[model samples]
Target: MSQPLTGVKVLDFSTLLPGPLCSLLLAEAGAEVVKIERPRRGDEMRSYEPRLGEDSANFVLLNRGKRSIAIDLKAPDALERLMPLIREADVLIEQFRPAVMDRLGLGYAALSAANPRLVYCSITGFGQHGPRAQEAAHDLNYVAASGTLSLTAGSDGAPVLPPALIADIAGGTYPGLVNILLALRQRDQTGRGAHLDVAMADNLFTFQYWGLGNGALGQWPGTGTDLVTGGTPRYQIYRTADGAFLAAAPLEDKFWQRFTELVGLDAAALDAMPPPQATEAVRAAIARQTAAHWEQRFAGQDVCTCRVVGLEEARRDPHFGARGLFSRTVATATGERMAALPVPIDAAFRATDATLPSPALGADNPLLDH
Candidate 1:
């Protein structure tokens, strides 16, 4: 089947996670992506630990199926060298702070003038015009400022760092991908492109929609006090006898009733007791049994409870294998295989062949000489 973005050309000027991952999705969907990196050092991610051949594992995972062109945008004739690629590209994405591209004379105004139908997207920590637009931040800071971090607290009631880069992938990459596709659709009709300003911090509030709605109504349940944040007995992690954990989230009444029964809880007594006492009772019961015991008991059940597996276990899970989540692999320069980073794009739109490895730094520089 023909891919959705088979003819689209993307010029990716972003680095690290957000921009690279977004362009990876575009490439998986059959867009031709050319990643522009610094002349020698390339993306900083190439130097991240756990190297795979010539680049880091992270760089290989995020940058598969893209061509590379190295250029010093600060060079006097940089614009002259980039003009051909710009004219041919349907999309351009950058992750610099506000006005950086403008200062380089490669801003949307200049690019769009050269190619009126180019979709120019800028992904930044904050919106282009915000008070904190130029402030430095990473995934942690963005989630912290958006109040998402406060919702995830440790047992001692202090906010904990999240295991995932929610703000980077959910806030920046997904929004950038969605908006770029939307701009392409708009261009199909109007024959004109748009400048997309995707602010990572601004997009994070959507992840806390439930809490935000409650806050707006003046029913804010303080940090870590909400239903899904360990406030109730029915929806929280419980320690097993083996010291492993089970994530129990039987929120609906039917599932909750089944879970309480399975754990030997007297539902009537639990209802009459204080919530904290009920929670403690459930925890105590869960701690009496091994995680393996609960894993077996909950098999084929719709209780929304399961053993908390480690990253390696998750990678080897039968369910994920059945879904073909880790079926794709990319070859390193030395021919060693590594799992391709998974994206949410559907199989119908994804390329079927093994993806190309991340390019060597400036491997496609000869194209610029033309």
Candidate 2:
């Protein structure tokens, strides 16, 4: 069966995380993604550690199934060379700072003239024409600037770094992908295109919708002091006797009651407002047994409890194996095969290619010909 995006073409002029990730999803959905990279050096992610062939494993994983074309935008003929692809492309993703594309004559205005149906997306730390539009930042900076980082904390009451790139993936890549698809749908109806400005920092606020409403009510949650952020006995992590952690989130009253019963705690302990003592009691009870013991005890219960396993353990679990997530593979330069990075797209929209490889630099540069 043909995929939904089987005929869509994407010109990816972005490097590193957000834009490349977005284009990767498009490619997985059967879009023809042609990555435009800097000449000679290619994407900087190729320099990242733990080499796979000549490029980093990170680069190989993120760029699998996409073709590459190396070109120096500063060169006089660069625009001319890219014009064909730009006109043919249905979607274009770029992450340069504001006005940088204009300097190279590749801004939305210039490209839209050549292809009126182009859905051009710009991913940045701050949006175009903002006070901090040109300010250099990464995932951490975007989270900090958005106030979402303040919600991350431990018992020490100090803010903890997030385990993932919250801003890059959740904010930029996801929003860019969603808006690009929406713009394409709108074009189908209106016979026009859109220039989307996706700012990672601005988009991070959507993750804090609850916090925003709380602030509107003059009840803003502080660091580590909210229902979902480790403040309540109903939703907190407790250490087992074996030193592993059990993440429990029985937020509803029924589940909380079941959790308290299973943990051998007095249900009234949590009924007291601002449950510091109740939380400590819950912690003490959990610490009395190993994670395995609690796993058995909590099994088949309404209490949402599970042991926190390491990445390797999680990957090797039977559940994920049964789901066929790792059935698709990408090969290293040496032909060593591993699971492909799991994409969020439904498998029905992706080809059943058993294995794919990342393209060599400029491997598809011959596309320039008429």
Off by over 4 Å in 1: none
* Model 1, C-alpha of 152: deviation from truth (Å): 1.4
Write one digit per residue (lDDT tens) for candidate 2, span 1-370: 9988999999999999999999999999989999999988999998899887888888888988899999999999999988988989999999999999999999999999999999999999999877899999999999999888878866686778889999999999999999999999999999889999999999999999999999999999787678888778888889999999999999998999899999887677667746777788898999999999999999999899999999999999999999988889887545656678989989889888868888778878899876
TM-score of 1: 0.98
Show the lowest summed lDDT stretch of 10 residues, model 1: 219-228
TM-scores vs. true structure, each candidate: 0.98, 0.97
292: Cα error in model 2, Å: 1.3
Clashes of each: 0, 0
Clashing pairs in 2: none
lDDT of 2 at 195: 97
